[model samples]
Target: MAYRLLALDIDDTLLKSNHRLTKETKEAVEYVKNKGVYITLATGRSFISARKVAKSLKLSDPYLITHNGSFLASHVKEPVFERRIGAETVYQVVDILENYHCHFKLFHEKYVIANKTRQKAQLISRVNLQLTDPLFYPVHYVESPSHRLIDQPLSVLNIRAEFWNKRERRDALEELEESVTGIRITPGGKEELFINHESASKALALQNLASRLGIAPYEIVAVGADMRDRDMVSQAGLGVAMGDAPEEVKASADWITRSNDQSGVAYMVKEVFRKQLRIETPHQ
Candidate 1:
Protein backbone atom coordinates (compact mmCIF):
# COMPACT_ATOMS: atom_id res chain seq x y z
CA MET A 1 0.00 0.00 0.00
CA ALA A 2 1.12 3.56 -0.62
CA TYR A 3 2.19 5.60 2.38
CA ARG A 4 0.21 8.74 3.05
CA LEU A 5 2.48 9.92 5.83
CA LEU A 6 6.17 9.25 6.47
CA ALA A 7 7.47 9.53 10.03
CA LEU A 8 11.27 9.73 10.28
CA ASP A 9 13.34 9.57 13.42
CA ILE A 10 16.35 11.81 13.45
CA ASP A 11 19.78 11.17 15.01
CA ASP A 12 20.78 7.74 13.71
CA THR A 13 17.89 7.28 11.32
CA LEU A 14 17.98 10.42 9.18
CA LEU A 15 21.27 12.15 9.93
CA LYS A 16 24.58 10.60 8.83
CA SER A 17 27.25 9.51 11.30
CA ASN A 18 28.71 13.01 11.27
CA HIS A 19 25.25 14.40 12.06
CA ARG A 20 24.67 16.31 8.85
CA LEU A 21 22.10 15.73 6.13
CA THR A 22 23.77 14.27 3.03
CA LYS A 23 22.96 15.75 -0.36
CA GLU A 24 21.40 12.50 -1.51
CA THR A 25 19.14 12.29 1.53
CA LYS A 26 18.13 15.91 1.16
CA GLU A 27 17.32 15.39 -2.49
CA ALA A 28 15.34 12.28 -1.71
CA VAL A 29 13.29 14.02 0.95
CA GLU A 30 12.68 17.02 -1.26
CA TYR A 31 11.64 14.76 -4.11
CA VAL A 32 9.11 12.83 -2.03
CA LYS A 33 7.91 15.98 -0.30
CA ASN A 34 7.24 17.58 -3.67
CA LYS A 35 5.27 14.51 -4.68
CA GLY A 36 2.77 15.32 -1.83
CA VAL A 37 4.00 12.77 0.70
CA TYR A 38 3.59 14.19 4.18
CA ILE A 39 6.98 13.87 5.86
CA THR A 40 7.66 14.67 9.51
CA LEU A 41 10.49 14.19 11.97
CA ALA A 42 9.94 12.03 15.04
CA THR A 43 12.82 12.29 17.45
CA GLY A 44 13.91 12.13 21.09
CA ARG A 45 15.50 15.55 20.83
CA SER A 46 13.79 18.80 21.78
CA PHE A 47 11.78 20.73 19.18
CA ILE A 48 14.41 23.46 19.25
CA SER A 49 17.02 20.93 18.24
CA ALA A 50 14.82 19.12 15.73
CA ARG A 51 13.77 22.33 13.99
CA LYS A 52 17.27 22.88 12.60
CA VAL A 53 17.03 19.67 10.62
CA ALA A 54 13.50 20.52 9.50
CA LYS A 55 14.68 23.87 8.28
CA SER A 56 17.52 22.24 6.39
CA LEU A 57 15.09 19.96 4.61
CA LYS A 58 12.84 22.99 3.84
CA LEU A 59 9.74 21.45 5.43
CA SER A 60 7.59 24.39 6.47
CA ASP A 61 4.57 22.72 8.03
CA PRO A 62 5.92 19.36 9.18
CA TYR A 63 4.82 17.84 12.44
CA LEU A 64 8.09 17.78 14.38
CA ILE A 65 7.61 15.14 17.04
CA THR A 66 10.18 15.89 19.68
CA HIS A 67 11.04 14.88 23.25
CA ASN A 68 10.10 11.28 22.56
CA GLY A 69 6.58 12.19 21.44
CA SER A 70 5.75 14.06 24.61
CA PHE A 71 5.34 17.16 22.48
CA LEU A 72 4.33 17.65 18.87
CA ALA A 73 5.52 20.92 17.40
CA SER A 74 3.96 22.15 14.17
CA HIS A 75 4.99 25.73 14.70
CA VAL A 76 7.94 27.37 16.41
CA LYS A 77 5.99 28.48 19.48
CA GLU A 78 3.78 25.67 20.78
CA PRO A 79 2.92 22.04 20.28
CA VAL A 80 -0.34 20.75 18.82
CA PHE A 81 -0.25 17.94 21.36
CA GLU A 82 1.62 17.83 24.67
CA ARG A 83 1.77 15.22 27.42
CA ARG A 84 3.41 16.58 30.52
CA ILE A 85 5.05 14.48 33.20
CA GLY A 86 2.85 13.92 36.23
CA ALA A 87 3.94 16.09 39.17
CA GLU A 88 3.84 13.27 41.69
CA THR A 89 5.71 10.96 39.35
CA VAL A 90 8.29 13.60 38.57
CA TYR A 91 8.88 14.25 42.24
CA GLN A 92 9.10 10.55 42.97
CA VAL A 93 11.62 9.90 40.20
CA VAL A 94 13.66 13.00 41.03
CA ASP A 95 13.75 11.98 44.65
CA ILE A 96 14.93 8.54 43.58
CA LEU A 97 17.51 10.08 41.25
CA GLU A 98 19.31 11.74 44.13
CA ASN A 99 20.47 8.33 45.33
CA TYR A 100 22.33 7.58 42.09
CA HIS A 101 25.52 8.95 40.61
CA CYS A 102 23.81 10.35 37.57
CA HIS A 103 23.32 13.66 35.81
CA PHE A 104 19.71 14.32 34.91
CA LYS A 105 17.74 17.01 33.11
CA LEU A 106 14.17 18.14 32.56
CA PHE A 107 12.76 19.49 29.32
CA HIS A 108 10.28 22.35 29.42
CA GLU A 109 8.47 24.00 26.56
CA LYS A 110 11.30 26.34 25.61
CA TYR A 111 14.46 25.35 27.50
CA VAL A 112 16.24 22.48 29.21
CA ILE A 113 17.06 22.62 32.91
CA ALA A 114 19.89 20.67 34.56
CA ASN A 115 22.05 20.93 37.63
CA LYS A 116 24.73 23.53 36.99
CA THR A 117 27.78 21.50 38.00
CA ARG A 118 27.04 18.15 36.38
CA GLN A 119 28.07 16.90 32.96
CA LYS A 120 24.51 16.55 31.67
CA ALA A 121 24.29 20.06 30.27
CA GLN A 122 27.72 19.93 28.66
CA LEU A 123 27.14 16.50 27.24
CA ILE A 124 23.80 17.50 25.74
CA SER A 125 25.37 20.60 24.27
CA ARG A 126 27.98 18.40 22.63
CA VAL A 127 25.24 16.18 21.25
CA ASN A 128 23.49 19.20 19.77
CA LEU A 129 26.77 20.31 18.26
CA GLN A 130 27.06 17.12 16.28
CA LEU A 131 23.49 17.46 15.06
CA THR A 132 23.83 20.98 13.78
CA ASP A 133 25.97 24.11 13.85
CA PRO A 134 27.12 25.20 17.29
CA LEU A 135 24.67 27.21 19.43
CA PHE A 136 21.71 25.48 17.87
CA TYR A 137 20.16 24.68 21.24
CA PRO A 138 21.01 26.33 24.50
CA VAL A 139 20.50 24.73 27.95
CA HIS A 140 19.57 26.36 31.23
CA TYR A 141 21.67 25.69 34.29
CA VAL A 142 19.77 25.60 37.54
CA GLU A 143 20.76 25.13 41.14
CA SER A 144 17.45 23.49 42.08
CA PRO A 145 15.88 21.08 39.59
CA SER A 146 13.27 20.17 42.18
CA HIS A 147 11.78 23.64 42.15
CA ARG A 148 11.41 23.63 38.40
CA LEU A 149 9.82 20.20 38.28
CA ILE A 150 7.34 21.27 40.87
CA ASP A 151 6.65 24.62 39.28
CA GLN A 152 6.34 23.84 35.61
CA PRO A 153 5.12 21.13 33.26
CA LEU A 154 7.90 18.91 31.95
CA SER A 155 8.03 17.37 28.51
CA VAL A 156 10.86 14.91 29.24
CA LEU A 157 12.95 13.49 32.08
CA ASN A 158 16.44 12.31 31.08
CA ILE A 159 18.92 10.52 33.32
CA ARG A 160 22.53 9.79 32.44
CA ALA A 161 24.32 7.36 34.72
CA GLU A 162 27.76 7.18 33.23
CA PHE A 163 29.17 5.84 36.49
CA TRP A 164 27.51 2.51 35.83
CA ASN A 165 28.22 0.16 32.94
CA LYS A 166 25.76 0.33 30.03
CA ARG A 167 24.02 -2.86 31.05
CA GLU A 168 24.13 -1.91 34.70
CA ARG A 169 22.59 1.48 33.98
CA ARG A 170 19.84 0.03 31.87
CA ASP A 171 19.05 -2.48 34.58
CA ALA A 172 19.14 0.20 37.22
CA LEU A 173 16.74 2.36 35.26
CA GLU A 174 14.41 -0.60 34.82
CA GLU A 175 14.59 -1.27 38.51
CA LEU A 176 13.89 2.34 39.28
CA GLU A 177 10.77 2.19 37.17
CA GLU A 178 9.22 -0.27 39.58
CA SER A 179 9.36 2.38 42.30
CA VAL A 180 7.66 5.04 40.21
CA THR A 181 4.20 5.14 38.67
CA GLY A 182 2.79 6.57 35.43
CA ILE A 183 6.11 6.79 33.62
CA ARG A 184 7.51 5.30 30.44
CA ILE A 185 11.20 4.40 30.34
CA THR A 186 13.37 3.81 27.30
CA PRO A 187 17.08 3.60 26.66
CA GLY A 188 18.97 6.60 25.36
CA GLY A 189 22.31 5.66 23.87
CA LYS A 190 24.34 3.29 26.07
CA GLU A 191 23.90 4.88 29.48
CA GLU A 192 20.90 7.22 29.51
CA LEU A 193 17.20 6.86 30.13
CA PHE A 194 14.29 8.71 28.53
CA ILE A 195 11.53 8.70 31.11
CA ASN A 196 8.19 10.23 30.17
CA HIS A 197 4.51 9.84 30.88
CA GLU A 198 3.16 6.45 29.78
CA SER A 199 0.97 8.19 27.23
CA ALA A 200 3.85 10.03 25.61
CA SER A 201 4.85 7.72 22.81
CA LYS A 202 5.78 7.96 19.15
CA ALA A 203 3.06 5.50 18.27
CA LEU A 204 0.44 7.68 19.93
CA ALA A 205 1.74 10.74 18.16
CA LEU A 206 1.82 8.91 14.82
CA GLN A 207 -1.66 7.59 15.45
CA ASN A 208 -2.95 11.08 16.20
CA LEU A 209 -1.40 12.42 13.00
CA ALA A 210 -2.84 9.55 11.01
CA SER A 211 -6.29 10.00 12.49
CA ARG A 212 -6.22 13.70 11.74
CA LEU A 213 -5.27 12.95 8.14
CA GLY A 214 -7.91 10.22 7.90
CA ILE A 215 -5.23 7.63 7.21
CA ALA A 216 -4.78 4.29 8.91
CA PRO A 217 -1.58 3.09 10.50
CA TYR A 218 -1.16 0.65 7.60
CA GLU A 219 -0.93 3.60 5.23
CA ILE A 220 1.84 5.19 7.31
CA VAL A 221 5.56 4.33 7.36
CA ALA A 222 8.00 4.97 10.18
CA VAL A 223 11.79 4.64 10.11
CA GLY A 224 14.01 4.74 13.14
CA ALA A 225 17.14 3.34 14.88
CA ASP A 226 17.34 3.61 18.67
CA MET A 227 15.41 1.90 21.46
CA ARG A 228 13.29 5.02 21.99
CA ASP A 229 12.32 4.77 18.33
CA ARG A 230 11.04 1.22 18.80
CA ASP A 231 7.42 2.04 19.61
CA MET A 232 6.69 3.97 16.44
CA VAL A 233 8.99 1.90 14.25
CA SER A 234 7.43 -1.42 15.15
CA GLN A 235 3.89 -0.09 15.27
CA ALA A 236 3.83 1.77 11.98
CA GLY A 237 2.28 0.18 8.89
CA LEU A 238 5.69 -0.34 7.30
CA GLY A 239 8.33 -0.27 10.01
CA VAL A 240 11.86 0.36 8.70
CA ALA A 241 14.96 -0.02 10.79
CA MET A 242 18.33 1.42 9.86
CA GLY A 243 21.17 -1.00 9.15
CA ASP A 244 23.19 0.44 12.03
CA ALA A 245 20.30 -0.11 14.44
CA PRO A 246 20.77 -2.66 17.19
CA GLU A 247 19.72 -6.20 16.40
CA GLU A 248 16.73 -6.00 18.71
CA VAL A 249 15.51 -2.86 16.97
CA LYS A 250 16.31 -4.23 13.52
CA ALA A 251 14.49 -7.46 14.34
CA SER A 252 11.35 -5.54 15.26
CA ALA A 253 11.14 -3.87 11.86
CA ASP A 254 9.43 -5.23 8.75
CA TRP A 255 12.34 -4.03 6.57
CA ILE A 256 15.91 -2.83 6.95
CA THR A 257 17.13 0.29 5.23
CA ARG A 258 20.76 1.24 4.52
CA SER A 259 22.84 2.88 7.22
CA ASN A 260 22.69 6.64 7.73
CA ASP A 261 26.25 7.09 6.49
CA GLN A 262 25.14 5.68 3.13
CA SER A 263 22.24 8.17 2.91
CA GLY A 264 19.78 5.54 4.08
CA VAL A 265 16.82 7.96 4.26
CA ALA A 266 17.36 8.93 0.66
CA TYR A 267 17.96 5.38 -0.46
CA MET A 268 14.87 4.10 1.31
CA VAL A 269 12.67 6.81 -0.12
CA LYS A 270 14.08 6.52 -3.61
CA GLU A 271 14.06 2.74 -3.58
CA VAL A 272 12.20 0.70 -0.97
CA PHE A 273 9.57 3.16 0.27
CA ARG A 274 8.62 4.69 -3.04
CA LYS A 275 8.28 1.37 -4.87
CA GLN A 276 5.27 0.48 -2.71
CA LEU A 277 3.32 3.40 -4.15
CA ARG A 278 3.12 2.03 -7.67
CA ILE A 279 -0.07 0.18 -8.70
CA GLU A 280 -0.42 -1.91 -11.86
CA THR A 281 -3.39 -0.92 -14.01
CA PRO A 282 -5.46 -3.41 -16.07
CA HIS A 283 -5.10 -2.88 -19.81
CA GLN A 284 -7.56 -3.79 -22.56
Candidate 2:
Protein backbone atom coordinates (compact mmCIF):
# COMPACT_ATOMS: atom_id res chain seq x y z
CA MET A 1 0.00 0.00 0.00
CA ALA A 2 1.14 3.55 -0.67
CA TYR A 3 1.53 5.34 2.63
CA ARG A 4 0.17 8.87 2.72
CA LEU A 5 1.29 10.06 6.12
CA LEU A 6 4.52 9.70 8.14
CA ALA A 7 4.50 10.21 11.91
CA LEU A 8 7.93 10.49 13.57
CA ASP A 9 8.99 10.61 17.17
CA ILE A 10 11.33 13.48 17.99
CA ASP A 11 13.98 12.41 20.50
CA ASP A 12 15.75 9.17 19.71
CA THR A 13 14.03 8.48 16.41
CA LEU A 14 14.63 11.69 14.46
CA LEU A 15 17.44 13.48 16.23
CA LYS A 16 20.81 11.86 16.78
CA SER A 17 22.16 11.29 20.30
CA ASN A 18 23.60 14.82 20.21
CA HIS A 19 20.04 16.06 19.58
CA ARG A 20 20.86 17.48 16.18
CA LEU A 21 19.01 16.81 12.90
CA THR A 22 21.47 15.71 10.25
CA LYS A 23 21.55 17.15 6.74
CA GLU A 24 20.69 13.77 5.23
CA THR A 25 17.66 13.35 7.47
CA LYS A 26 16.36 16.77 6.48
CA GLU A 27 16.84 16.04 2.79
CA ALA A 28 15.14 12.68 3.06
CA VAL A 29 12.16 14.27 4.77
CA GLU A 30 12.02 16.86 2.03
CA TYR A 31 12.19 14.16 -0.62
CA VAL A 32 9.28 12.22 0.82
CA LYS A 33 7.24 15.34 1.53
CA ASN A 34 7.68 16.51 -2.04
CA LYS A 35 6.15 13.21 -3.15
CA GLY A 36 2.83 14.41 -1.65
CA VAL A 37 3.30 12.40 1.53
CA TYR A 38 2.33 14.37 4.62
CA ILE A 39 4.98 14.49 7.40
CA THR A 40 4.22 15.46 10.99
CA LEU A 41 5.97 15.15 14.34
CA ALA A 42 4.41 12.87 16.91
CA THR A 43 6.43 13.70 20.02
CA GLY A 44 6.02 13.72 23.75
CA ARG A 45 7.44 17.24 23.63
CA SER A 46 5.22 20.27 23.95
CA PHE A 47 4.32 22.31 20.87
CA ILE A 48 6.78 25.03 21.78
CA SER A 49 9.58 22.60 22.53
CA ALA A 50 9.02 20.86 19.19
CA ARG A 51 8.97 24.08 17.15
CA LYS A 52 12.71 24.29 16.46
CA VAL A 53 12.68 20.86 14.82
CA ALA A 54 9.57 21.74 12.84
CA LYS A 55 11.17 24.98 11.70
CA SER A 56 14.29 23.09 10.64
CA LEU A 57 12.19 20.67 8.59
CA LYS A 58 10.49 23.74 7.02
CA LEU A 59 7.06 22.52 8.01
CA SER A 60 5.32 25.85 7.43
CA ASP A 61 1.89 24.67 8.55
CA PRO A 62 2.11 21.05 9.67
CA TYR A 63 -0.10 19.33 12.18
CA LEU A 64 1.77 18.66 15.47
CA ILE A 65 0.98 15.71 17.72
CA THR A 66 2.51 17.00 20.94
CA HIS A 67 2.46 16.09 24.64
CA ASN A 68 2.18 12.46 23.71
CA GLY A 69 -1.14 13.13 21.95
CA SER A 70 -2.67 15.36 24.58
CA PHE A 71 -2.58 18.13 21.98
CA LEU A 72 -2.99 18.31 18.21
CA ALA A 73 -2.48 21.73 16.68
CA SER A 74 -1.20 23.49 13.59
CA HIS A 75 -0.39 26.72 15.40
CA VAL A 76 0.32 27.53 19.00
CA LYS A 77 -2.92 29.37 19.76
CA GLU A 78 -5.08 27.53 17.27
CA PRO A 79 -5.66 23.94 18.32
CA VAL A 80 -7.55 21.42 16.22
CA PHE A 81 -7.86 19.14 19.23
CA GLU A 82 -6.60 19.25 22.83
CA ARG A 83 -7.08 17.49 26.15
CA ARG A 84 -5.90 19.34 29.22
CA ILE A 85 -5.44 17.86 32.64
CA GLY A 86 -8.25 19.02 34.87
CA ALA A 87 -7.30 21.80 37.28
CA GLU A 88 -8.02 19.63 40.30
CA THR A 89 -5.98 16.75 38.95
CA VAL A 90 -3.11 19.06 38.11
CA TYR A 91 -3.01 20.43 41.62
CA GLN A 92 -3.20 16.97 43.13
CA VAL A 93 -0.24 15.81 41.04
CA VAL A 94 1.82 18.85 41.92
CA ASP A 95 1.10 18.36 45.57
CA ILE A 96 2.09 14.73 45.42
CA LEU A 97 5.28 15.36 43.49
CA GLU A 98 6.37 18.09 45.89
CA ASN A 99 6.87 15.43 48.54
CA TYR A 100 9.66 13.95 46.45
CA HIS A 101 13.05 15.33 45.46
CA CYS A 102 12.48 14.92 41.75
CA HIS A 103 12.32 17.85 39.36
CA PHE A 104 9.11 18.26 37.37
CA LYS A 105 7.72 20.53 34.70
CA LEU A 106 4.19 21.28 33.59
CA PHE A 107 3.88 21.18 29.82
CA HIS A 108 1.96 23.88 27.94
CA GLU A 109 1.58 24.87 24.33
CA LYS A 110 3.42 28.18 24.57
CA TYR A 111 5.79 27.71 27.50
CA VAL A 112 6.89 25.26 30.20
CA ILE A 113 6.48 25.87 33.92
CA ALA A 114 9.05 23.96 35.91
CA ASN A 115 10.35 23.80 39.42
CA LYS A 116 13.30 26.09 40.08
CA THR A 117 15.19 23.11 41.43
CA ARG A 118 15.73 21.83 37.91
CA GLN A 119 17.66 24.91 36.94
CA LYS A 120 19.66 24.88 40.15
CA ALA A 121 20.53 21.22 39.80
CA GLN A 122 21.37 21.65 36.13
CA LEU A 123 19.65 18.44 35.25
CA ILE A 124 19.97 17.33 31.63
CA SER A 125 21.76 20.53 30.75
CA ARG A 126 21.92 19.66 27.07
CA VAL A 127 18.19 18.99 26.90
CA ASN A 128 17.55 22.04 29.04
CA LEU A 129 19.04 24.15 26.28
CA GLN A 130 16.41 22.83 23.87
CA LEU A 131 13.59 23.18 26.38
CA THR A 132 14.62 26.70 27.32
CA ASP A 133 15.18 28.05 23.85
CA PRO A 134 13.77 31.54 24.26
CA LEU A 135 12.75 31.82 20.64
CA PHE A 136 10.94 28.51 20.67
CA TYR A 137 10.08 27.14 24.11
CA PRO A 138 10.71 29.45 27.05
CA VAL A 139 10.81 27.93 30.51
CA HIS A 140 9.47 29.57 33.66
CA TYR A 141 11.12 28.48 36.88
CA VAL A 142 9.35 28.89 40.18
CA GLU A 143 10.05 27.90 43.76
CA SER A 144 6.64 26.45 44.42
CA PRO A 145 4.88 25.53 41.18
CA SER A 146 1.78 24.28 42.95
CA HIS A 147 1.25 27.60 44.70
CA ARG A 148 1.99 29.49 41.55
CA LEU A 149 -0.51 27.41 39.63
CA ILE A 150 -3.18 28.02 42.24
CA ASP A 151 -2.74 31.73 41.63
CA GLN A 152 -2.39 31.64 37.83
CA PRO A 153 -4.36 28.48 36.87
CA LEU A 154 -2.98 27.71 33.43
CA SER A 155 -4.08 24.83 31.22
CA VAL A 156 -1.52 22.03 31.59
CA LEU A 157 -1.11 19.40 28.87
CA ASN A 158 1.08 17.03 30.87
CA ILE A 159 3.74 16.77 33.59
CA ARG A 160 7.26 15.35 33.22
CA ALA A 161 9.54 14.62 36.17
CA GLU A 162 13.20 13.70 36.34
CA PHE A 163 14.75 11.68 39.12
CA TRP A 164 18.43 11.30 39.83
CA ASN A 165 18.09 7.88 41.36
CA LYS A 166 16.47 4.79 39.89
CA ARG A 167 14.85 3.73 43.14
CA GLU A 168 13.40 7.17 43.70
CA ARG A 169 11.99 7.13 40.19
CA ARG A 170 10.31 3.80 40.78
CA ASP A 171 8.95 4.88 44.16
CA ALA A 172 7.58 8.07 42.69
CA LEU A 173 5.85 6.15 39.94
CA GLU A 174 4.26 3.78 42.41
CA GLU A 175 3.11 6.57 44.67
CA LEU A 176 1.65 8.60 41.83
CA GLU A 177 -0.16 5.61 40.39
CA GLU A 178 -1.64 4.70 43.75
CA SER A 179 -2.74 8.25 44.55
CA VAL A 180 -3.77 9.77 41.28
CA THR A 181 -6.96 9.37 39.28
CA GLY A 182 -7.64 10.41 35.69
CA ILE A 183 -3.91 10.47 35.01
CA ARG A 184 -1.52 8.16 33.17
CA ILE A 185 2.09 7.82 34.14
CA THR A 186 4.50 6.65 31.46
CA PRO A 187 7.85 5.69 32.93
CA GLY A 188 10.33 6.79 30.31
CA GLY A 189 13.20 5.12 32.17
CA LYS A 190 15.02 5.04 35.45
CA GLU A 191 15.50 8.79 35.24
CA GLU A 192 12.12 10.21 34.20
CA LEU A 193 8.38 9.74 33.93
CA PHE A 194 5.65 11.45 31.89
CA ILE A 195 2.18 12.15 33.25
CA ASN A 196 -0.76 12.78 30.98
CA HIS A 197 -4.43 11.92 30.60
CA GLU A 198 -5.11 8.19 30.58
CA SER A 199 -6.69 8.54 27.15
CA ALA A 200 -3.64 10.24 25.65
CA SER A 201 -1.28 8.25 23.39
CA LYS A 202 0.56 8.97 20.15
CA ALA A 203 -1.52 6.29 18.37
CA LEU A 204 -4.78 7.96 19.37
CA ALA A 205 -3.54 11.35 18.25
CA LEU A 206 -2.31 9.97 14.92
CA GLN A 207 -5.66 8.31 14.34
CA ASN A 208 -7.45 11.56 15.05
CA LEU A 209 -5.23 13.52 12.67
CA ALA A 210 -5.45 10.84 9.94
CA SER A 211 -9.24 10.79 10.09
CA ARG A 212 -9.38 14.53 9.67
CA LEU A 213 -7.09 14.32 6.64
CA GLY A 214 -9.17 11.47 5.16
CA ILE A 215 -6.12 9.21 5.39
CA ALA A 216 -6.87 5.57 6.08
CA PRO A 217 -5.08 3.64 8.82
CA TYR A 218 -3.35 1.42 6.26
CA GLU A 219 -2.01 4.48 4.45
CA ILE A 220 0.16 5.63 7.36
CA VAL A 221 3.81 5.04 8.25
CA ALA A 222 4.97 5.60 11.83
CA VAL A 223 8.57 5.51 13.07
CA GLY A 224 9.81 5.66 16.64
CA ALA A 225 12.57 4.47 19.02
CA ASP A 226 10.90 4.17 22.39
CA MET A 227 8.42 1.90 24.08
CA ARG A 228 5.95 4.75 24.37
CA ASP A 229 5.87 4.60 20.59
CA ARG A 230 4.85 0.94 20.59
CA ASP A 231 1.16 1.53 19.97
CA MET A 232 1.72 4.11 17.26
CA VAL A 233 4.26 1.94 15.45
CA SER A 234 2.07 -1.18 15.62
CA GLN A 235 -1.03 0.61 14.41
CA ALA A 236 0.58 2.15 11.35
CA GLY A 237 0.41 0.42 7.97
CA LEU A 238 4.20 0.58 7.74
CA GLY A 239 5.61 0.64 11.26
CA VAL A 240 9.34 1.26 11.59
CA ALA A 241 11.51 1.04 14.69
CA MET A 242 14.96 2.54 15.10
CA GLY A 243 17.72 -0.11 15.21
CA ASP A 244 18.61 0.91 18.76
CA ALA A 245 15.02 0.69 19.95
CA PRO A 246 14.00 -1.77 22.65
CA GLU A 247 13.39 -5.36 21.58
CA GLU A 248 9.66 -5.13 22.24
CA VAL A 249 9.31 -2.01 20.12
CA LYS A 250 11.24 -3.67 17.29
CA ALA A 251 9.10 -6.76 17.56
CA SER A 252 6.00 -4.63 17.05
CA ALA A 253 7.41 -2.89 13.99
CA ASP A 254 7.02 -4.11 10.41
CA TRP A 255 10.62 -2.99 9.76
CA ILE A 256 13.66 -1.83 11.70
CA THR A 257 15.89 0.89 10.33
CA ARG A 258 19.48 1.70 11.29
CA SER A 259 20.25 3.44 14.54
CA ASN A 260 19.78 7.19 14.79
CA ASP A 261 23.52 7.85 14.65
CA GLN A 262 23.66 6.05 11.29
CA SER A 263 20.99 8.38 9.90
CA GLY A 264 18.21 5.79 10.03
CA VAL A 265 15.47 8.24 9.08
CA ALA A 266 17.31 9.18 5.93
CA TYR A 267 17.84 5.53 5.03
CA MET A 268 14.18 4.68 5.59
CA VAL A 269 12.87 7.60 3.60
CA LYS A 270 15.20 7.18 0.65
CA GLU A 271 15.30 3.38 0.65
CA VAL A 272 11.62 2.81 1.36
CA PHE A 273 9.57 5.84 0.32
CA ARG A 274 11.74 7.21 -2.48
CA LYS A 275 12.67 3.83 -3.91
CA GLN A 276 9.11 2.57 -3.75
CA LEU A 277 7.81 5.75 -5.36
CA ARG A 278 10.31 5.28 -8.17
CA ILE A 279 9.22 1.67 -8.68
CA GLU A 280 5.58 2.72 -8.89
CA THR A 281 6.27 5.52 -11.41
CA PRO A 282 6.31 4.04 -14.92
CA HIS A 283 8.94 5.13 -17.44
CA GLN A 284 7.25 7.35 -19.97
The lDDT leader among the candidates is 2
Q: Candidate 1 — which residues are off by over 4 angstroms?
A: 118-125, 128-137, 147-164, 167-171, 273-284
Candidate 2 TM-score over all chains jointly: 0.93
Clashing pairs in 1: none
What's each prediction's TM-score?
A: 0.85, 0.93
How well is each residue in 1-284 modelled by candidate 2, as lDDT tens digits? 67788899999888998888999999998887777788899998888777668889987778899998899988889888888898888888888888887888888888888887644356656547557366667788889989997998776898988887888888888888998899888777548898888888899999999998888899899999987899999999999999999899999999999999999999998767865462222111
lDDT of candidate 1 over 99-192, digit per residue (tens): 5656666666565666555545556555445333335454666776777667864545333333235655655686677788777877767477
Superposed Cα deviation of residue 175, candidate 2 (Å) = 0.9
- Highest TM-score: which candidate? 2
Model 1 has an lDDT value of 0.73
lDDT of each: 0.73, 0.84
| Runs of candidate 2 exceeding 4 Å displacement | 118-120, 278-284
How many pairs collide in each candidate, listed in order? 0, 0
